[model samples]
Target chain A: VEFGGLRAHCPEAALHAARAAYLAGCQATSNVEAGSRFGIPVSGTMAHSWVMAHMDELTAFARYTAVHGARSILLIDTYDTVAAARLIVSAGLRPAAVRVDSGDLAGLSAAVRAVLDAGSLQETKILVSGDLDEHRVAALVASGAPIDGFGVGTAVTTSADAPSLSGVYKLVAVERESGMVPLAKLSPGKRTVPGEKQVWRVARSGETQRDVVATADELGPPGGVPLLRRLMRRGVPTESAPALDAIRDRCRTAVAALPDGVRRLTDAERFPVELSPDLDRLSRRVGGRDDQGP
Target chain B: VEFGGLRAHCPEAALHAARAAYLAGCQATSNVEAGSRFGIPVSGTMAHSWVMAHMDELTAFARYTAVHGARSILLIDTYDTVAAARLIVSAGLRPAAVRVDSGDLAGLSAAVRAVLDAGSLQETKILVSGDLDEHRVAALVASGAPIDGFGVGTAVTTSADAPSLSGVYKLVAVERESGMVPLAKLSPGKRTVPGEKQVWRVARSGETQRDVVATADELGPPGGVPLLRRLMRRGVPTESAPALDAIRDRCRTAVAALPDGVRRLTDAERFPVELSPDLDRLSRRVGGRDDQGP
Candidate 1:
């Protein structure tokens, strides 16, 4: 939800990041424009700079609580984590959460959780952040870190580990006077399939079994559901454009249906994308790779 | 000047990127917003997608020439680099430049240059792109590739290799009723120097010798030029905010003054950022490393 790092990039990038994160199921974003535009909740823990700006860590927490009340999530790792947690309890401030942004997150979260529980302030949550990604989140969860939530930043915003997706937008067909003509790039090591295309997915017992990339004109193989739909006509969006929530729900269902290998945090198996017979034939003909071309 | 990838990020991001690049000595930007905002020239080569969208590559080139005339930079590596170069010369379409977006940039550019020369179209420039960074650009230059210009994307926009800078904003001192009070963070593996600071550069002739970060209030050591100036006061920018062109010129001068190691494409020696004696003493005292703490 924190987009301060991205703000230095540009206002729109930060806003777009917030929108994408909201659409992808993040609970809230710290960017005000995103909150206003998307109707998502806005929340943020205080920064280390804020804590350092005050005379002491306790003073910063107390001042922030006074201003933001229980809604404030006090950042506890500017100087020390345990001392700050103790100070929060001693000051009788029952904030919504205590965030640990540095140090060993697993140990810190556990220690903070135990202190909050012992003080009968079990309602206060423990939120961990700092270089967290899906793999790190899973590791913390597996270790029973007593974390209530996470404040993901860099890793989420930039897709840091795998920063760029291997996505390509090749023109499948060209509009001609007669009809739509298939196009293909036959460069070695960079060949592209020709013709308008659609992907059909096969699911068995709620799990996706396979997918076929085929020509868009066909109804596709039996027992498979087409994954692409016409969403735009000219410059106008069609009725097929679903509401954000519906799209998010559908995305959740689709992701859940994927096999375990594709869902793993690391070394995920590549999902099969088989080309249909029609698509293969069109590709070969337009690419000048047929028997007659030689 | 190419900014298609950034335009896909966000309009503001694209604009800001263009502004930054222009201010960093780039001659022009492909972003129209930047051109309008900063009075910088805008230029671009056609995308492969545009060519693929048409019935054929030649048709696309002809249509683009009819619209853009000699200003057009025809992209030639969509299907085959050599074949497209031959077509360009044969078709009598004299574009300003021919760009290679894929393949061995060095070899392809040389081949394209030779073909253009043989056809007496020697005025055409050779532009190269695709996963290009400083090192790759340097390699092309070192190998004497016929490249006249480059269209750097991902690496520059994302700051990919060193994606994130280890930037921190520690409140060195807080404003109090009587005076400014210095503060410090004493966390293990992370320490902050106490007090307001300024960096002084000691340059000899046209080359930089060293830099010293010291407390702001003091007159820096002899012959050292203070690099930090008062830019703003109480949320209002001071007169110190110069025009972008002036800032750009200053940046160029400063960069030129840097040592050779700092300018090298790889394995550059880290620039020294030493603290002054008083600043060092203050850091030690406030960080509690002067004596062991329990």
Candidate 2:
């Protein structure tokens, strides 16, 4: 998500963005205490390239700390996890985290933890990262092995299960000379509900929700307002837009409100999306039953 | 792959990149022509979102064609592809291509082709695309269907066979006052070959040859020179770098040259990468042995 390799990247933009979010700036090792206040975790891990560039594990740790900060997790499995852990402890940097990138997560975690305990360094944390997803994270935690936060990358960036978002925009209701005409596309099984649309959610007791589609000129169901509110007007963020924390909270609520079926990992039924009569009529007028259009 | 959405997006960088690559700039319709000129087949399929946006396949076709050119394929199965093919032909456009994004490839292709032939527009090519890879392509071609080209997206992007490249760059030789020193990393199982490496690949005596690696400073076995010519130096493409077409040809050659074992569809023996004795000696000085600095 961070535009690391873009042109005109000064490295200061990362620092500034972090600061604006009231989070730690880049390579700010002393700001671990700021974690509680900012709620943004200080994190990074050893790349295979870095491990190979430096000759030895100890030298790699020394150089990494010199460049990044003292809190750098010495990558244990560059060759052997247990052996590297022993060397890292011997170096006396206190080894904030011992990361295992590849290999059996449960077995490696158990063995590494044992090695740390055997060395009497109880403070070292275990961080596991490599192709981890929410499902995998839940599974790993369920296994009763001790591990801290995840370093999710490509899967998150790519959203592998659903890479492309189907979010779309259309001229649902365009201003016209005679009257405000409601427009819609009625393409076989791909017919769209017509008019400037508003989606209202009817929540029965508990976490259940039913979505209703209505015309822009009319009010929707008695309860929830439209989920797709104006995010921007004429190419600028609106002042009332929620802050990141608030947005995260809203997201938590939205995801939580899902009635289980929609959130399932497999074949899931879509939530109901019934339309108002006026919108349905407008759709019929524009889309057509036969191939004829007028 | 195609943005598909027609929103009034601002002149942002990401959108610009997409616009440059896919939208309206020498847009490729068919593969043979695209491959001949572009050197890479620029291809795509009609997304379901587009199908769903419009009502009735014919109306959808009219709207999409009114905006984009008529040279594009008609996605038939948004409702029922075979039926839609009749409508498209009746509409007099006689589409250049008819895409079937889903359903039984063999059965559907045969049925649709039968229907299209009954209408006497056999030249209206049938292009099938849905989760196709090299294996599926080979199979479909073997089955003797009339697919013009492929619209490879997910498998190509993800590199499903080998998700991530195991390529690692290491500082093999750093200069010292005494002599050029070689470095090696010995972290557990991660033992690296030493030396500022030159990967010299010697082809075994034939057009279809297996390659062996050698040090750049050393002569190749029999007659292999060097493969590790600097691809990029001081942020410039090397003169040795071929044109796009030539590079594609070379890729075809190298891929063809891959040993039958390496090309197999399973866990295979890795290509051998050799190290020189001088580099090994330097590695010993740096990290070849156990224990820390003397």
Candidate 3:
């Protein structure tokens, strides 16, 4: 994934986004800091400016290939996609890939592919990118376009549709003279579940089931695996952090175990998360709704 | 403007956004880094979690006021806004301001204002913030809501509607053995105008009329003011950077000098920007369109 868009926000945000992208199974990233920090492979293609800097497009491709050898990924859409591909092949230059940053990606990729094949440069891959989002990538893949890779930036890094996370920290409990008292906001449209809680993921025979949110002291249901662990205590880490690759592996495994319906990109089925009986009763008591409950 | 949203993007983005906000006349920011870097005042209100951590809303307000004195900006929407305001008055605590983070801001601010005024705490100001954009702030002002200040966050910092800038560095000229030669890209929908250029802002009296883009060596039209200046020479500073306050003043003057139509928040009239005769000729020649032009 190309992380150039990350530089438009904040360094902390870029770091977090790079880590999240890695955890989500992004094979390589264009973010050098992320590569060094997380041990992810760093990869990138040439920019259109590189091609424009030289006297002509063909000369630019040749110079880049001579310096970077077979690792060079020439950007071919500076003037024309098909013409650039033909020129590269005609000059006997073999770049690892050619990226099309604009135009009708699927159609241009097919046309470029044909030209490359005609010149016997079949090994050169076609990469496409330009304001690409999840939906666009899916459509391109569905169209069977001969695209070798996607260099996504803006959509993934900025999260254009949902730009900011709505996560908030709430005080679930406050220590009092009596030890500890559970607290819950009665604010309209902003209520919080009171007290410490634990989430138990119930899976049976390799098929995942629903999650149960119960009070921290409650016992887990049958075949339920606890999902929460103490990461820090009293401003200090409780244990050494897991390696990035190990965390990525766990993320991949967890995502693969999800049901097909819940894993869909669009119209995804909501993953069921139920409140345990004890937790439901506690919620009722804290919310002053116990009069209506047994 | 609260710059918390800037943290969601990148440090460079945050710095640029903070500078832009300062230039656009933002009085203060919640970003301490921005404040120290740009000389903008740092200001912020308490979080809901602060109120939630206390035994009750009244106690939280009392403690916050006791510590911060009249400078305290108490968050009043934890459980109930009006109730919290009334509680503060009844308990004889006078905070500098009360901030409402959610609900119908106009109605709540009016209600809270009435409660504060009736209790003779007329000096206390009212601030409101909750996913507020320019439109919402303008609407609140138009409705004559008794709000004293705004704590905008997401919309301004993230530019929710237009998340990213489409700026590009193009190769406009190349130096060779024969001297400098201008170049222009013929890329579809991404053409460059070619060569160094100067932007001249034409103004009459105190009102900005239009802008003219001319070739660098071309003479400016009568009453035209050059907008670009050299900032660096051979990787060294050409001149000391202007003070932040001076830049802010310049920005204010420039914005105020714009025509009313062009300054409107919605349906803003596009500022006219015409190409000068010499630049037009250069463009035509570089684009190989001289055959069609006089």
Candidate 4:
């Protein structure tokens, strides 16, 4: 994952984006701070500027490999992709990967792969990048391209198509002169449920089946696990936060437990998230729509 | 300017986005860090959560205005735009401005304006904000919406349409045994000019007419002002940086001096930017195509 696009927003965004990508099962990130802070492996190829700085493509490749050795992921699209791969093989420079950052990635990766394989450099992987999103990546994979890795930047970091989330913090309850009173808004297109809530996840054979949003005071349903824990109280943390790696592992496992229909990228089936009987009753009463059935 | 959207990236980006919006002639920012760091005025109405926290919309308005007084900018769209305005006027709450954040802004602004005027709260201004960009702002202005100010966020902060800038730092010249040698990249679709360069802006009648990109050593053309200044030499300071307010003033003045065609929002005429004769000659020579005419 290349989080450089996130840097356009702020330095902290870069770190957060790197962590998010890691938690989403991304194997590596091109952010150094993420590597040092979260232990996510840092990997990236050279920039086009590096190649332009040298006298020729071969010299740039040779110099970079000399310092980084086989770990160097040569950026070959600075001049020509296939030609650079041939030059690397002809000069016996073994790079961990060759990255193509421009042009038709699916077609270019195949051509570059053929050149590398012909030179007995089958171990050198092919990495493709440039305006890659989930749709493009899926299409590339479906096309049977020889891409070993993908370096996604802007689309993932900026979430360009839908740049903002609509999450809001609502006051579910307020302290009155008498006691704590549950609250709810009847605003048009801006309604809210009353009182504090909890989400209980029901799993079957290690796969998540559904989730129930219920009043905080309610007990978990049979065979269901409470997902919310008191992490903070009275302006202080209630417990030590989990390690970054542990959190990442949990995220991976959670995603894996999602049903196939819900996990699909396109036309995804909505995961069941029903309101519990207690919460539903509270919502109707607070909204002043007691006649409506649950 | 509502730079809250920029916070999605990083804290630093929030500061920079606030600065950029301020330099672009935005009067105020919603970001407090920007207010302290850049001395930009901070202004914001209230969140929906604030309204929902109270027992009723009127109570929310009364409580907010009690603290903020006439300076309060009440958010009216939490329930109903016109109804909220009517409520504010009937309750004798004189807010400085009323903000609308949803629906047809053009239609709602006029309706809210009518309500405020009917109640003899003529001094109360109408502010509108949701997903405003330059185009939407211009259209609103053209449609004669009585909008006093705009709270722009995602569009200005993220530059949603074109998010990432394609800027790359290339090695222009190398110090060699003999002397400095200019370098150029012949990469397809990624060519670069040789040597260090400077931009000379030519203005007439206080309006910028054109700019010339020339070799650093070349003399400025007649009536041309050099735009690049050396702030440091060998990593040491050569001069003090200008204060943020002073820089903001300079930016405002510079933008005002642009020709109307170049400043127009839609299908704007491209500002003339040509390479100087000396630089053009050098580019052809460095590209190894010396036979090509300048």
Q: What is the C-alpha RMSD of each candidate to the true structure, in Å?
A: 3.5, 7.7, 3.7, 4.4
Using alpha carbons, what is the TM-score of model 1?
0.89
lDDT of 3: 0.82
Cα lDDT tens digits, model 1, B1-294, are: 545345235566566667777777777777777788877778888877888776568998999999999888998988889999999999988999998888788999989999999988899999888877778989999999989998876665555555444566777777776577777777666677788898999888879978999999877977899988877889898776568789789888988999999988789988888899989888878776342121
DockQ of each: 0.34, 0.16, 0.37, 0.30
- Candidate 1: where is the Cα deviation over 4 Å? A1-8, A53-55, A70-72, A164-168, A240-244, A289-294, B1-8, B49-59, B240-245, B289-294
Cα-based lDDT at residue A260, candidate 4: 95
lDDT of each: 0.79, 0.59, 0.82, 0.82
Candidates in order, TM-scores: namely 0.89, 0.64, 0.90, 0.84
Give a tens-digit lDDT track for model 3, residues A74-172: 888887789988898889898888899888999999999999999988998888888787899999999999999998876666666766655667777
What TM-score does model 4 achieve against the real structure? 0.84
Interface RMSD computed for candidate 4 is what?
A: 6.2
Over B1-294, each residue of candidate 4 has an lDDT whose tens digit, in order, gives 564543345567767888888877888899888898878889989887788667678988999998999899999987568899999889988899999888789999999999899999999989998768889999999999889888888777765665565465677787655567787755556678988999999998888999999999999788999999898899999999888778889998998999999999988999999999999989988788342112
Q: Model 2: per-residue lDDT, tens digit, A1-294?
A: 111211111223233334333321222211233344445445556666676555456887888878767577777776667888888767776767878876777788888888888887778889876666667767888898878655543343233454333354544544445565555543344455656777777776647477777766677777766766777889998866456466556666776778899887557779777877767776676676442223
Pairs of colliding residues, candidate 4: A10-B10
- The interface RMSD values of the models, given in order, are 5.2, 8.0, 6.2, 6.2
Ranking by lDDT: 4, 3, 1, 2
Clashing pairs in 1: none
